[model samples]
Target: MTPHPAPQSRGVALFDLDGTLVDTTYLHTLAWWQALRRHGHTVPMVRIHRAIGMGSDRLLDAVLGPDRETGEDEALSDAHGTLYATWYDSLQPFEGAAALLRATAARGWRVVLASSASEEEVAAVRARLDADDVIDAATSSADADATKPAPDLVRAALDTVGAEPEEAVFVGDAVWDVEAAARAGVPCVGLLTGGTTRRELEDAGAVLVHDDPLDLLRHIDAGPLARPPAPGGTS
Candidate 1:
């Protein structure tokens, strides 16, 4: 069960970007792999995908481990930014993702995007989602002191929307996202739209798991996301 209030409830909806919205986890993994290989580290895609939700700095360290010493977190980030920027024009929103956000926004929930992507990448995705008017605000790793699996990013997003923990819900695909949202005191709605398995997402802290965005949209009302009808009418 989602601990946070429903969509019509007085709260903000904080969302994770990469896999949750844009379906680009594998792309991110490949991009990081290319970046690492350019610097002489040959990491497998399978390992890199699991770490896709983490920011580039953390992903590099996670992939490269603590053994290799390099001060190029900035350089690698720059390379990724340059490479990933090219995909913005081609990025596609996941099924029902835009509608879900819009519906929640219409229902009185303030929508905010919380991502672990770089500033450049987050901007690209925002452009792709093009939900600027509907989205109350957005938070990226650039806006946070730490990355996902840490509560800072979620806290920043909540602050941006000016919503308290009890007044919000976080939706995401990764286990780290679950942990982060948990630390921030928000319920996590897990969607298996990304590459991760349902069992993994459920075990991570997802009270309700759905097949994808469309599945979630269909069940929003009865699934604990439907708040009491709004003031004038039902949301």
Candidate 2:
């Protein structure tokens, strides 16, 4: 009988874009706020800020509620997209964000970006991040049927890298990210750069929490990403 091939063990590191690596959380909040207002809705910025990690559809449902008129949803989303795109050229990656991706890749992790942003937006963020050399893959909203708090995006990232749930770790800056990772059976490390509280992240199932990419890079060896790979796996 022929012997079966052993399991491939290189772990996967999934990173969330937007507020996690880029300084666009508030920008997103502002855009969504303006979009809603333009559509004659008046949701609070604070609420919009908290819903930044979700996809536009989910964000609309979240801030506007299920009872909201569905006819204007497309217009609201388009308005927000146009507003947010105005800042594309000005987007900046967080401190150490590129280094973090490089460091994770150097440690044998296949780094993948898991985001709910549109393809164009992801491209803008990636250009600002300047870490494409080390990124094994990246997934945008078009790659998933659902967004954060639903696990589809997270799972899509895993599939892109051919990684099993146990062989991957996700990093993000929101409770929605943590919750999504949890539902996908992947542990998540939370960052506070998105303005989420430590307690809120913890409550949502983050394995560890840090202030930002710089902070997490400083302690990378102590977090879930530092854990040894499974037996028969390399790295």
Candidate 3:
């Protein structure tokens, strides 16, 4: 048997689940709107959509304003959780999602998932991929001190995979993900699966933009994700 080269031994590919790996950003937007409506907060879907990448706490604050008392946060987040639960299977991983992860693993790269999603929600999402064979480690907001655009979440993911900040690349669909990756000093790759525009992602610090996880998967073997092909396949 051929030896498996460990691409991830030194650097890992960190992923943001929602817009980055799955097509659940808009679903999350609707869920948040319903959750807020249940609380009489009535946030607009557009704003909710814009805030989808943020963890519930940050999203609530973004839509509800910083003036909201910290005490109300837990209840609101719970409501959103219930609302989001209705769509557990509504979300499907983007094209090439599993392949991206598995291929990364095949290349000996450690694959880690980092998201603002709660533990249960993230578990459901990961279960859909069934990439237990590929994913090396994972982190969710439930385990992080802060969410995206802050680098805390990304750092948590790297730490989970026992990776260093400089040796990883983060992929996400939101401007905040780009910002967070930049802050963490990791290169950012943008996925258009989220609602954020290419310009916005670039402005936030994404250097490359792809259609989705699949696109990244197809191109990854060529870039920082690993060394070049093993050979004999270019023919």
The candidate maximizing TM-score is 2
Top lDDT: which candidate number?
2
Worst 10 residues of 2 by lDDT: 1-10
Candidate 3 wrongly placed segments (more than 4 Å): 1-8, 228-235
The sequence of per-residue lDDT tens digits that candidate 3 reaches over residues 1-235 is 0012234255577888887787888888887788778777877799888887887777777888889877878888888788878878767888899888877777666678877788888888887777766677788776677886788888777777556776677888998898888888888889899989888888887879887887787798666665422222111
Pairs with backbone N, CA or C atoms under 3 Å apart (clashes), candidate 3: 7-108, 8-109
Using lDDT as the yardstick, the better of models 1 and 3 is 1
Could you estimate the TM-score for every candidate?
Answer: 0.90, 0.93, 0.89
lDDT for each candidate structure:
0.78, 0.87, 0.77
Cα TM-score of candidate 3: 0.89
Q: What count of clashes does model 3 give?
A: 2
Candidates in order: C-alpha RMSD to true structure: 4.9, 4.8, 5.3
In model 2, residue pairs whose N, Cα or C atoms come closer than 3 Å (at least 3 residues apart or on different chains), thus clashing, are 9-233
Return the lDDT, model 3, position 69: 79
lDDT of candidate 1 over 114-206, digit per residue (tens): 886766678788788777767777777768878878898898888875567777788999888888999998889988867888899888888
Give the TM-score comparing model 2 with the true structure, all chains together. Answer: 0.93
| Model 1 TM | 0.90
